[model samples]
Target: MAEEVEARTLSRVAWRFIPFLILCYFVAYLDRVNVGFAKLTMDTDLGLSDTAFGFGAGVFFLAYFLFEVPSNIIMDKVGARRWIARIMLSWGIVSGSMAFIPEIASAIGLSAEHTFYLLRVLLGFAEAGFFPGIIFFLTLWFPASHRARIVGYFMAAIPLSSAIGSPVSAALLGLDGAWGFRGWRWLFIVEAFPSIVLGFVTFFYLTDRPADATWLDPQARAWLQRRLALEDRRREHVSPSSALASLADHRVLALSLVYFGAVACNYGISFWLPTIIKGFGLSIAMTGWVNAVPYVVGFFGMIWWGLRSDREGERTMHLAIALALAAIGVGGSAFLADPTTKMIALTIGAFGVFASLPIFWTLPTAFLAGSAVAPGIAAINSIGNLSGYFGPFVIGWIKDATGGFLWGLVTIAACAVVALAITLALGHDPHLERAPEAAE
Candidate 1:
């Protein structure tokens, strides 16, 4: 009877939340990285070099890192539903405004380059806390045993955005001359509209917590609340209660380093993958399709790896192995000259790059609870995302100097190796997953 109730309650909650959240993140991620696709043509229009584009693309993370912790704190205080809706609405407006960079720059008497940097900074500011906020929000509903897979399902949006959005964004590029705007301009305006619309939908659609889930039967609601509360109690018993203090914890810092490595590889490749594929002499449309290859592989890898981690009740080895694979694949891609062989290697690297993420998140949430959850997650995310700045900037800088992407790929691969070592050293305690028997 207990097992049946648990299954039914979790299933209901998953159905209610996961699909909608995936749609939200799918659009969110697309807006964030579609700039990559834009770079193919936007560079010539804006007079941006590889270095300029990289710096502009990367500066978003600087703003993201600065505001992330505070944003998460505010979400904790206000409520995820309203705050997240606000984030989406604001970012949508800013993201759409990206279409008008030249006009805005002309109006302000600034170069288009400066205007690009400024808007990306604002977009980052508006989108801050969104990802960590969602992570913290999930813990309020799901148990530790369920988190890796749930996070996997949610984060699958990252690759899904690139996979589907790649071809779509490429296709939209064909609309270059429409309404006197360039194709990349159309890309920004059309893609950003969904976020603005979904922001409104999210407000009415989301329930802040399970206790307020009137859509659920009373029995299922009660079961979910009891289960979640019991798990919170178990976590609170050993974890730090103060958010500020938890930021100083060793585990948090170590995990941030591990994430830094993973994110470095992620953003570095994300910002440059289109350029890499375009060098193969493919048309813009073909570049979009081919660039999606790795992400398609990553999409499946993320889901399968997260499920395997949860099923086996393991964290450290899973994370370590993924990082190791990422290092090898990325490093190998740097040397392979053939487009086919290079893409095959990059696809393998993408598998490791994405597979490490959902499992990595499970580590911190396993221990951090109560007041610590928001800031702790935010700090790790903010600190780790600093690599987002360095990753692209470094890749761009190296490309300008070496006239190729060879060393850039190697640099990110080294970061992954460092992360693999740290994962082994920091490790994880599965005992934290246990809940008090009374709730069951």
Candidate 2:
């Protein structure tokens, strides 16, 4: 009876928090990737060359890298509720502001090139802290054992947002001139408003910790608190100041390398996939709808991997195998000349790349606990994001130079192979073998 009751209670709490996390990420991702959709129109309208578009796209990660660690540390000090709300509201306003950049440039008589560059830089700074902040926030609610599945579910927001945004952007692009705005401008305006509203909702609904939550019954609250205490007690103690030292450890460094490779492939595909598909002579509207299919496949793939990882109680093997599959899938997409074959390959690649995300997060949360967990997670993510800059820039350069995406996909495949080797080498780390109790 007690076990059943506990399960039911936890399920209710999970339902509440998980969806909010997913929604927060959904908006974050929409802001992140809407630029991809916008590129379909904005590049031409703003007279941005291929290099300029790629640079602007990649710039978001530069700001993301600079602010990631500091933001996580701030979230740690101020609590998730306020920090996240602030990030959302501020970024939402900036996201909406992107709609007016072309006008601002025209009004100021700046060259078209300079205006787009300025807007992209500002957008990057606004969105800097979101992903790492969410990762740090998850530690407060879930134990190491439960975190992979939760992270998997949370990470699913990326694909889900893409799934929804692709068609919505397609629809918005079709609405060109409805309100005296270009389709891309409407895309920016329409997508951004939801984030501001969701930010207010987050402020109202989210609590920093279970102990701070008054909505739960006393029994439920006490039960959650006790379980979290036991989990926290099981881990070794390290002060927040020493957190960066973990980066010097071989195990953490190896994991960061793997993360770097995975993100390279992940973001490379995300930023370029629509353009790759459109190269096959599809219309912009069709390209938008078709772009959604791979992410739809990815959504299911993430759930399958997440549940399987939770059941198996392991991460390295799952990540390694998935990354290897991604290497083949993406490589095949690039190498194959047939449009149909390329679509199939792209869908397979999407599934493999996204499926590995939850497992990637699990490795860190499992190994690093308490105060060390936030900074350590942020550091890994911050370093891994270096690929975001490299991925898009390299892909754009390859496409421009070779007149094909084949070399770009091949490069990402090689990165995946390296990630696989790193994952295999990871078993020797004492961190992976430690009991969950010890992680606390």
Q: How many pairs collide in each candidate, listed in order? A: 1, 2
* CA lDDT scores, all candidates in order: 0.93, 0.80
Residue 220, model 2, lDDT: 78
- Candidate 1's clash total is 1
Clashing residue pairs found in predicted model 2? 234-437, 235-440
- Candidate 2 is scored at a TM of 0.93
Q: What lDDT is obtained when candidate 2 is compared to the true structure?
A: 0.80
Task: Estimate, for each residue in 294-314, the C-alpha lDDT of model 2 and write its tens digit.
Answer: 999999999899889877777
- Ten-residue region with minimum lDDT total, candidate 2: 428-437
At residue 358, give the lDDT of candidate 2: 91
Highest lDDT: give the candidate number: 1
Top model number, TM-score: 1
- Note each model's CA RMSD in angstroms: 1.1, 2.5
